[model samples]
Target: MDNQALSLNNTIVATNANVLSMLSERGKNIFFPKLGILAQAAQARGKAINATIGEAVEDDGSSMHLPEFDALVNMPTANIFPYAPSFGKPEFRSLWKDSIYRKNPSLKETVISNPIATNGLTHGLSMAAYLFANEDDTVLLSNHYWENYNLIFENNYGATVETFELFANGGFNVADFGKKLNEIEGEKIITLLNFPNNPAGYTPLVSEIATIVAEIKKVADKGKKVIVLIDDAYFGLVYEENVFTESIFVELANLSENVLAVKLDGPTKEDYVWGFRVGFITYAIKGGTAELYEALENKTAGAVRGNISNISQLSQSMLFKVYSAPTYEQSKKEKFDILKGRYDILRDALSNPKYAEYFSPLPFNSGYFMCVEPKKGLVAEEIRKHLLEKYSTGVIVLGSVIRLAFSAVPQAKLPELVENIYNACVDLDK
Candidate 1:
């Protein structure tokens, strides 16, 4: 009779009259305490996390001559310290165009430049939901997504987030993705695909990438609007041979006119500059006027101006300087090598026959984290809890999987971490 029992027993269908009454008054849903907490926080404009945000400066305390950084700090002309134009600085946006090409030259014909800088990728995501997604639209999400995406789409935008498996037997499962695509009975189907994916650490094979683009094209050819959002938060961190070295944006752009690809990427992970908070949103339309591009840019800027005013000009300045450096690629490669070293340790540690059968890799080829699926019959959460409470080693849990980030763990401490985790899972059978 009460709310608790109604929720547990799934007896809400009998409340049709009550639901209709509430809907007419715009009080259409029952209250949950977490939603109330969120409401209060939103009313406060995110001040709860204010003190923790640092306009952080990085220094080793040993290098007095920040030769490059000095130029970055003292030599910016327009987009430093002042308010960035709602769309962004014209110079920075132009530079961003050049940067995108340096990696994916094929985007010259397919993608357009309607970029808006956000404080971070999360802001870009919020804008994505607002600009395109209708309230009751369905978002076909990758099976293993970044955990918080649900809070944004389902909670914030009132859209259904469905899942399509990223892989089946250690590679992209074309059939699974196609099956899910067919099930969505809508003209505008939206999907969020994260590469160098969050927990799985998998990227599509070139053939698989081709298949994906082709299928999205198939959907678009049916006169449907398909928005393929490529979350490249960890772009360019490839440590393996065939796991998509190119951005998915390149693949999507090659598809039909109806396929709109939005890429959300940032300096946070790739540049090893977390506090810099420099991120951008880019749209790849099949065709558009420069003025149409400008109009979209203005709308995006409207969102930026409404949310955080603008991203810090100082961080943008610093990153632009880095992007211009001759050794930028070399510097990025050095860090990638370090990450590869850490992942190597994790791979070898897990390969020991003693622990090999307990779990499987999420086709891990790139990115900071890897997904660990429990062995047949053993649930992922049980193993995860066993590891943390028993070993004091913390890790993230995603449904029936464990997300192990090799980037955060030091090389020396890694063996111990994996050993403890494996043994914990082994102990689970007891």
Candidate 2:
């Protein structure tokens, strides 16, 4: 390992041995070089005779860019063209950190590492897996998950993904979660928790969140190390009153020294900037200090530097501007209301007795989608094919369940979409 990596490992070990133990082999060897090109470039920043980096810049310290590309965005060319710091723009990182506190009020008193930018939530998860997941390591998640998780964690990193039934008795299956955690045979456990879960779109209620936290803590209490990756990609999209509005990260952050919570979230879904490809990764653990977090941040930045080098400067800059706008919250609420309207239509449509015979709707109150399992003697893929061919409707089929994205359909078209799905199932059954 490089001396810098050794130094970082020592620092992490000194602060919290459990955290150091959770790192994978690659993570242990990865370090942000303090004497590298980026470091020298930083030292030469604002110099009268600086030529440390490769990017072309005018003598007046302005970024050189084509007028055609520069005219597209209203912002300055420097913000659009410059290479963002590997950890992300300092101002933007701070702004996002503040927003986390604002959105998750329970985290105001808690201490967490500053957020580091990623290309998107998927990249954020890949980064976390790079840092913590070792070959043959088991990743626990809900059975109803985003399929890409298998590509990111298992295929990319060679980790094993074990699943627990996502729902039991019309809510989160806390018992199954605890059972799965206990079944894993190791002192180190990594789990990814995605709320407003993909496909199912279910967010746990407050009591459910409390129970989930308790279950994680139980594992931590057993002298085991736990790394919780909270994927809050579809955060702040809840339509129902009883759903847990705050992130479960708030409870997991300071739960135990044996547990480290890494939160992956960004503007993709929260601010309706899906194409921006900007996301963030944050760290928190019990008794974590500023120095400890800084060390982790450096390692995380090293990972970022090694991977994509850095996120897009234009995306980060544009989002920073959007976040600063006075109308940002109101605009987000406006969009949320539209999605909630669609959700209401789907929920009411699914409640009808006619569709229940063909398909059973899963419990869902948040996020972009909800799933339904075909009734007995019906095949989900057959229904999906029937929908596509007969009705020109598209829906995702996973095993026996079909996922419907209410977010994609117009409010007026949601009922029709649901009806088409039901018709497809009936056609397949016949």
Candidate 3:
């Protein structure tokens, strides 16, 4: 390991030995290069004769850019053209961290590191995998999880994915989850909890979340270290009354000395900025201090530096501006209301008794999608193909379930979409 990496590992070990033990070999070896070119350039920031930076700048230190491109975006040239800090733009990171507290009031007293920017949630997940997932290590996930998780955790890092049924009895299968955690044969446990889950769009009830937390705590109490990655990509999109609106991160953050909660979320899904590709990763551990969090941040920054160099400065700058606007909150609420309207329409349409014989709708209350499993030996893929060919409707087929992204459909069209899906299932069954 580099001297810097060793220093970071030592810092983490001093603060929490359990956290240090949970790190992958790569995590323990990665460190932000403070003595390199970026460091030197930062040191020369205010010097009269500064030339350490690589970007083209005018004598006055203004970023050189094409007038055509500059006219396209209203942001200052410096904000778009300059390379962002590997950890992210500091001001934007601070603002986003503040927003997390605003969004999850339960996290008010939790000690979490400032958020680090990434290309998107996928990048954030990859970063977490780099830091913690090792070859052959067991990673617990729900069977109804986003498929990309396998590519990131198993394919990229060689971690073995162990899955539990996502739902049972029309709700989160808390019992199955506990059973999976108990079945793991190691001292370090890594699991992902994605609320408003990708395909099912189900956010657990508060009591269910409490039970989940208790199950994780049980593992921690057994002298095991736990790393829980909370993917809140579709956060703040709950359309129902009884859902656990606050992130599960809040509950897990202060749960145990052996538990490290990493939150991956961003504007990509939450703010309706799919093309912006901006996301953040944050860290929280029990008994955490500023120094300990800073060390973790430095190590994560090093991973960012090594992998993608940094997140897009233009996207970060644009989002920062959007966040600063006074109308930002209202604009977000408007979009949320629109999506919630679609969710309501889809839910109502799915409730029709006529569709019950074709397929069964899964429990869903929030987020962009809902899934249904074809009934009576009907294959989901066959139903998907029938829908596409016969009705010109498109939906994703994941094993035994078909996923519908109701958020993309207009409120008026949602009923038609659901009806077509039911018709397709009926056609396939015939």
Candidate 4:
């Protein structure tokens, strides 16, 4: 055998021999960071405020009253028990596609494929990673991204992540983004964009969104294949009037063939059904065909078949009924208003002068959570533990930033929650 061939064989065996090494190089290096301990302890301790989980809750801290969706659970027999197609129920796929475009009317002229169902938005991203990226391929993401993306893209798919600073001057950093895209020359790239972003909870302004679409087109114009995945998991939850209201996918879909736009979204956050696990992946390739979509759908279905086989039938059935109902619009608005109330209360409370001594809030105009960078070199992990043990308040701490999911916190409780956080930081200073 050739010397190079023998060396490659030896490396493969060494990697497979160590069970941990079977994971991609990136996976072997991850620490599986967790901060759910506070949530768990809060439950056991009782009356502990939970600012951890992102689900919406009632004023008394109970789960949101979703009487409107009760009928979804009692669907006709065929909807409940039988297995669904690996791709999804055809009607559900069509309905989801219609719903997406209906909400974002600017996409009416764009060439886009029908939506394909997955277990959740997370699985949709995983499927996209499997299809577009290969071992050691680079994925450009913002530095402040959801933690799960690491496991899905890098660990499982063996892709390497390249990060650009997510914020500059309190907005999207277009110049830095363009620089990063140009730096890695002559490679087909996969770039991920998440709006109503997790942890930070900021969506781009209209001008920023336009720049993002233009930037990807420039990359594609340079003859490099660019797959842009838009993670719109927290779609349409914006609380501000000035922020861009639609998915940037609409403009991107109309761009060059070299750029493929894949949108990952679901009813989990939109419909307030966190446990439903019903999400979709829709693609757009200019001048693409039904046959092309079918081919792409088959590969995604094969992945789902080999793994979970299919998403839960009951979940899809429930979502279908919810989508089909005439009252769905009104029901969603009711829940949105509730979340908006909580969002506004938190915004107002954070504006209090007293809290400024502890931390400064980041740019947050939408979504479930808002992040803060603590003052005085305070460590987020230490403050998290101090808040849990001393004040019985639970918040998610990521590195030096602290994230509070106001969606789960009642409007009436906002003042107290802010007070506890202030106290926690002051006590830690001593």
lDDT of each: 0.71, 0.92, 0.91, 0.77
What does candidate 2 score on TM?
0.98
Cα error, candidate 2, residue 380 (Å): 0.5
Off by over 4 Å in 3: none
Displacement of residue 29 (Cα, Å) in model 1 is: 26
For all predicted structures, in order, the TM-scores are 0.80, 0.98, 0.98, 0.82
Model 2 lDDT, full chain set: 0.92
Poorest stretch of ten by lDDT in candidate 2: 421-430
What are the runs in model 1 whose C-alpha is more than 4 Å off? 1-80, 108-111
Which numbered prediction scores highest in lDDT against the true structure?
2
Give lDDT tens digits, candidate 2, residues 1-430.
8999998888998889899989999888988889878778889887779878789988677898888985589998878998899999999999999989998999879999999999999999999999999999999999999999999999999999999999999999999999999999988999999998998999999878999999999999999899999999999999899789999999999999999999999999888889999999999999998888888899999999999999999999999998899998888898999999999988998889998788888999999999998886888888888888999999999888999998999999888888998877777666
Residue 30's lDDT in candidate 2: 89
In the range 76-190, model 4's lDDT, one tens digit per residue, is 5457655677788999999888888898999886757778788899899897776666798888988778999999988988888898888899999888888788776445777
Give residue 101's error in model 3 in angstroms. 0.6
TM-score of 3: 0.98
Q: How does candidate 3 score on lDDT?
A: 0.91
Residue pairs with backbone atoms closer than 3 Å in model 1 (clashes):
none
